[model samples]
Target chain A: MKLHELTIHEASDLLKKREISSQELTRAVLDRIESVEKKVDAYITIAGETAVKQAELADREISRGNISPLTGIPVSVKDLICTKGLRTTCASKILENFTPQYDAFVIKKLKKAGAVIVGKTNMDEFAMGSSTENSGMKTTRNPWDLTCIPGGSSGGSAAAVAADMCLGSLGSDTGGSIRQPASHCGVVGMKPTYGRVSRFGLVAFASSLDQIGPLAKDVLDCALLMNAIAGYDPADSTSVPEDVPDYTSFSNKGLSGMTIGIPKEYNETKGLDPEVSGAVKNAVKVIEDLGAKCVEITLPHTKYAVAAYYVIAPSEASSNLARYDGVKYGFRDKEKNSLIDMYRSTRTKGFGAEVQRRIILGTYSLSSGYYDAYYKKASQVRTLIMEDFKNAFKSCDLILSPVAPTPAFKIGEKIDDPLTMYLSDIFTLSANLAGIPGISVPCGFSSAGLPIGLQLIGRHFEEKKILTAAYNFEQATDFHKQKPEI
Target chain B: MKITKDEVVYTADLARLDLSENSINRFADQIGDILEYVDTLNSVDTEGITPTSHAIFLSNAFREDEVKESMGADKALANAPEKEDGNFIVPKVINL
Candidate 1:
């Protein structure tokens, strides 16, 4: 296999054996990106020169007998994560020229591990949409088919990994942003428990629901990335003081004693494509055949998830985004007369339609007269949803479901209808709401040849369990081995 | 659920965003649809359930109160759209 095509684990082994140097691997990946980037549009910034320099440094570290699993590995970061001196736009025009002076905690971790920073990937503006079409810059197409979306707001990261542009990627999930894209792109994406990873540098979406995790070609690679980034940091108050395990150690554990629950409500979801349902059922049978029991379960509050998420995510976004007024940083309008006029004009010009729509929705919901009816009500319902997951976990070790209601839809398919787009994330949002670990692994493909993903969710901080299950499924199947022909 | 153009304008004003007449109508219709869907939460009985502001049960995080170095003014003002000496420059707020 080419250097660009090697998973992080495979590439690390080759590097350790002195079979390939980090500079060569980084160069091969950069060459692949240059060849296919126009067709894939997977990155917002390609830090080619810096990546090679970093890889050379990693090679020197390797020669000195100092190395981590991620040392010399090339990884892409979603544009939402802060990377010092690199333009991190969140795919929004407001901060198109904004650059951070310091790295995010996760970026600091990746740098400390000697990982080569490849570039920043695109996303839905402010991570408010399910598809990257909301990106103010460029539309990131699914690698499998140029016409379909690599389900987003982490679309570019998933597409980058699927197209072999990067060994692995870091993506922040607010509500299925990571998993849904990984599903559509046919890779492994994990959204760890809410506080499992620090949020000190992630561009805030929904403060309570957002978490940064890894997207890679395989589950083991995802786990390796997790080990480097997870654990508590004093910088973020919400970060939990939980001990992170040796995630790579859980890779080969079989599913013999595990009891997987299939949420009956997921099967009954309206508009769920029959092919996706079939693929998930087949995956469950495969796991059962491997000596695990699959029992039907119910998260009774499933239907309320999307409803509650809309209110809660947007409410938080409105408050978090209020800092982009006109002075401190980002774009400012010169045509406005008054200070308030400048703020209004700058925002109106800087934000996209979807962002404007969400801001308005959030502002409306949080307004004094309506707060009790909308924001407060959503929070209360969020409690019920969390309780539902807590109760369901009592009967099973992990819950199995389809990551998304269907495989990726064509670009511009649901962009016009905001409600239709929001419903697409129905299957993946609850994991975020419940603050549990969830992963998407390639299961099968639609007749149209689009990738379908099977989701496994575990209780909070149970990433190792879900990773093990996903790795077992990956080992038993060749879905992850198949790559987009781009 | 039936958000009127007036309500959209009101909300936009509250958000400190300027919306054109065309956008006002569009936002009103779109936001009305989303609000209608979100209104389903009202149907569920949440009588005694405490509102969950966060997914995890995290208390106030405490840290050492000792002073530490912060980002220098040059770096802090790196991305400022307009700056003066060592401060971000904005529209005049006080007439006096």
Candidate 2:
């Protein structure tokens, strides 16, 4: 295989045996990125020089027998994660020139493990959209079909991994951002249980729902990345003080005793593409054939998830994003006459249409007299959704479903209709609402040759169970091995 | 659940944002559609269910109140859009 085509585990094995140097691997990946980036537009920044330097340093450490699964591997980070001295724009023009002075906890872990940081990948502006067409800088195309979106706001991360520009990438999931894009891009994307991974320096969208996870070429690589990134940190108060297992250890565990639940509501969801439904059913059959049981389950509140999420996510986003009002950092309106005028004008010019739309919706929802009807009511419904998951988990080890209603659509297909775009995430939003771990692994492809993904969701902090199941399915099917011919 | 343009304008003002007439109208329509959809939550019988502000139950994370090293003035002001004498400069907040 070409150096750039190697998964994190594959490259790590070669590096440990001295069969290849980190610099050679890093260079081949950089060369691949330089060759295909124009076609994919998967990255907002390419840290070529710094990555090579880091690779050299990793090689020195590897020779001394100090090795981890991710040592010397090239990994891309979503632009929202803070990286010291690197421009982290969150794909928003407002912070186009903003660079952090400190590293996010996850970045610190990556550096500590000797992983070379490839670059920052693109996303929806402040993670506000389902497709990366909302990116303020560039549109990230699906490597499978250049005309289609890569799914988003983690589109660039998924695309970069799918195109072999990097071995793996880190992406944050808020309302299906990572999994939907991973599904669209035909890579493995895992969102760990909320609070399982510290959100210390992730640029907040909806603080309660956002969790940083990995997108990789396969489930093992995803597991390895999870092992490195998941852990408690005092920096984020929401971070769970729980032990993070060696996720890699769960890779080879077969599905002999696991019971997978297929949510009846998901199966009966309206507008679900027949191709995706067929793929998910086929995936369930595969898991059953491997000695697992598939049972019908119902998350009765599933119908309310998207509705509740719209209110909850945006309400939190509006409050969190209020920090960017021509203040200490980011964009400022220099021509304003007063403080309030400057705040208004700076936000007007800095934020995009979708962002402004969300801010307005959120503000209206949280406004007096409407709070009880919108925000509070949505929170109560959110509790019901969480309870639904809690009840369903009693009968199953994990829930299996489609990640998105369908594979990636055309780039501009749903951009104009925000409501329709929001519905695309119907299948994936509940996991975030319930604060559970979920993963997307390629299962089949549509007749049009677009990739389809099977989503596996587990109870909160049950990443190992879902990863094991996904790894077993990956081992049984060749779907994940199929890469876009970019 | 029709969101009026006036409501959009009011919300925009509350959000410290300035929207053009076209944007205001478009948002009013778009947000109205979304609100209509989200209004489905009103039918759910949430009579006694406590509002879940967070997904997981977490208590206040306590730490030793210690003086720790922080990003110094220069580093903190590094990304400031406008700064003077190591302090972020903004539009006048008060008029004496």
Candidate 3:
């Protein structure tokens, strides 16, 4: 049995009731990894022996009658988060051998709660790609359809969760990495408010836009995981000081008097499937029937989010990735005698082409003369996008939209065309830019049998509200009941 | 709407990522296509609207400087790809 599929609530109940030891649950996952991991390409590295040892300790504690909510539950983390003593490669050749000597703040928190970390999931090289296809090792395939991509940067976590490799996983969303893959895989993913979770040990992508969140099967399970992971951290300077409420407790309050606004501006079809739109409209009717008021709202600057995000993200990335020079750490070339030769040689061999392109574009934008023209203007456009969201929220308690234009496309469909690949993030990027919470829950199935996600977005640090709304919608619909045949 | 080999070479040098002639040619074609598409951003009317950067409305978020303990020297150098007796070894930074 793949114990990784059991929800935190399920696993916690079993452990509390003494039905199964934490060691047994952890062993079951390790056995599944031995059998099914090769087909999914989901993990970069498996800490199997260490995980077993930790689970054994957890089992001993429970035998002594010591337990926490996460005492025995196995949680998967994105490779980008640092794990002390484990080889934490951000799915890049440069960091292939760089093991962090200290656990990240999030890891420290998880350890305190007695959660067993199974392994690190694969990702784009430093969270750069829309598909984990950009992983230096190999592309992660979707559990639902092996031929299609598992939406990426966080693709491995999504794939692992969907395939029963892990019950829940963490993903860092720079630009729709978590929610998009969750949308594609027919699971639940959350992008918490920017400062709600700390970013201390996560490999930096776009500093301002990056956020770490949970991907699980149900909204309540996600909230349970989020309760342990969220809240302020002194290690992360940007972490906000706010009291984290019991999110799982608030989820049962259905959306009776809530006002959900649908941005008519998002109704435009750059690539949105008509069938997906119809499903979203139908979902709105369901919400209205639940006593929530559905109103039409306008977020006129919605279209510009993608254009601004690409420019700003690359600009920040170009500067952030500068630390990978063959000098201090990561991959270094011995063949080159000179310093410049070594830098060029090491990076040339280490980084993929798409990564190189973004770095160059960013460096050019941030260069003296071009800074005002590209980077500055993009920042200004970013302000407009945030303002658009602020005004939209005034008209409603929450905003709802389709997660993407369509379901997962074939593996090689947009690989050659970079612009098309970037366009897929249009609906999700604005939420990140606005620093609000957005959840992608399974909405309905397309005629093609692929999953469609209805994105529920709320105000800053309002994760509970978003989860409640999504749960209410979920309870009314039977979409989350269907699981992929893996 | 065309790019020359010179621009590709310049971009490659600027990025410090070694690119073969074949990769350069492919990038120029793909990048040129994207640049043309992004030109659509110019059509929007901003008028008096100001451009935005950060989403959260916070101004300053800086941590107070405090002395923290450091790891033992041996543990620090354990994961370095190349290391000297106690420090990380790297290509000399003579040029930059």
Candidate 4:
């Protein structure tokens, strides 16, 4: 394979053997980005010079016999993750020119592992939408088909990996940003358990639900990226002090003795395309043939997950986004005559339509006399959703479903109808609400040549289980080996 | 569940946002639909079930009370649109 198309593990092996220089790999990736970035629009800022410098530094480190699994590998970062001295826009105009003063915890980990950051990827503005079309910066098209959306708000990262512009990338999941995009782009993405990775310096979308994770070419690359980023950090209070196992160590442990629960509710979801469901069903048959037991299970509260998520995510978003007033860093209104006018005008102009809609929804829900009816009721339903997963886990080791109801839709398909777009996230929202770890692995393709992903949800902090299952499935099938003809 | 333009304007004002007349009507219809969807939560039985503010419940992470080096004023205010005397400049809060 070409240097730009090499996975993290493959590139690291070649680097360790002194067969390929990091400079060559970085240059090849830069050339690839230069060639395909116009059609993909996967990146907001391209740090070509910085990547070359970092690759040179990595080469020197490798010569000294010091190398991590990610050393000398070029990776993209979602624009929301803070990189000191790098413009972190979150695909929003408010922070378009805002450069962070310090690296986020994950960025620090990636840098420490000697990974060269290629650039920051675009996303839905402030991660409020499911499609990257909501980005104030640019739209990231699915590399598989330029007319289709790369599922978002991590669309750019997935597209970059799919198009081989980067070896791997880091994307955050609030509802299903990371996994859904990965599914659409035909890549492997994992949303590690809540608090499995630190959130310090990650622009908050929904503080309670957001978790940073990895998207890569294959399962092992995802695991390698996960190992580098996952762990406790004193910088983020929500980061749990749990033991993170060596994810790569769990590979080759086949599906024997594992019980995969197929949620009945997932199949009953509205708008679930036949091709996507068929792909998931075929994935289950492959797992069952690999000596795993597939049994039907019911998550009775599944229907309420999307309803609960909208209320909770937006409410927390409104509260967390209150810091972006004109007085602080970010855009300001020069035409303001009064303090209130400044705040109102700056926010009105700085935020996009979807963002404004969410902020309004959140404010209305959290306002006096309405908090108990909206926020509290949603929280109560959230408890039920969590309990549903907790109960399902008692009967099975992992729950299997389709990552999204259908393969990627056209760019402007669901952009106009907010409610229709929200319903598209029905299958993936429950995992975030429950704070469980979930992964999206390529299963098959739709007849229209779009990729479909099979989701495997595990109990809280049971990433090793899901990773092992995904690794075995990948070994038994060639879905992940297939790449978009970008 | 049907939010009016007045409610949208009121909520936008509460959120410190100035919405145009077009956005007011648009947002009212959109948010009203979302609220109506979320109102489905009311049909479920949640009596005596405590609300979940966070999925992974953890107590406050307290640290030793000690002064340490923090971000310098320059770094903190580096991205500020307007700054003076190492402080972010904004419209006057008081009109005496």
Model 3 has an lDDT value of 0.84
lDDT of 2 at B18: 83
lDDT minimum window of 10 residues, candidate 3 chain A: A1-10
Question: Any runs in candidate 4 off by more than 4 Å, and if so which?
Answer: none
Clashing residue pairs in candidate 4 (N, C-alpha, C atoms within 3 angstroms): none
Give one digit per residue, the lDDT tens place, for model 3 in A426-474: 8899898888889999888889788889999999988988888888888
True contacts kept of each: 0.93, 0.93, 0.57, 0.87
Candidate 2 residues A298-374, lDDT tens each?
99999999999999999999999999976778888799879999988999999998998888888888999999999
Better of 1 and 2 by DockQ: 1
Candidate 1 segments whose C-alpha is farther than 4 A from its true place:
A251-253
Q: What DockQ do you compute for every candidate structure?
A: 0.88, 0.87, 0.57, 0.87
Runs in model 3 deviating more than 4 A are A251-253, B2-4, B45-51, B62-64, B92-96
What are the per-residue Cα lDDT tens digits for candidate 4 across A193-284? 99999999999999999999999999999999999999999889999999989999885857889999998888778899999989988999
Q: Which docking class does model 3 fall in?
A: medium
Ranking 2 against 3 by DockQ, winner: 2
Give the per-residue lDDT digits (tens) of candidate 1, residues A32-58: 999999999999999998999999999
Clash pairs, candidate 1, are none
Question: What is the lDDT for A262 in model 4?
Answer: 93
Q: Estimate each model's TM-score.
A: 0.99, 0.99, 0.96, 0.99
Candidate 4 structure lDDT: 0.93
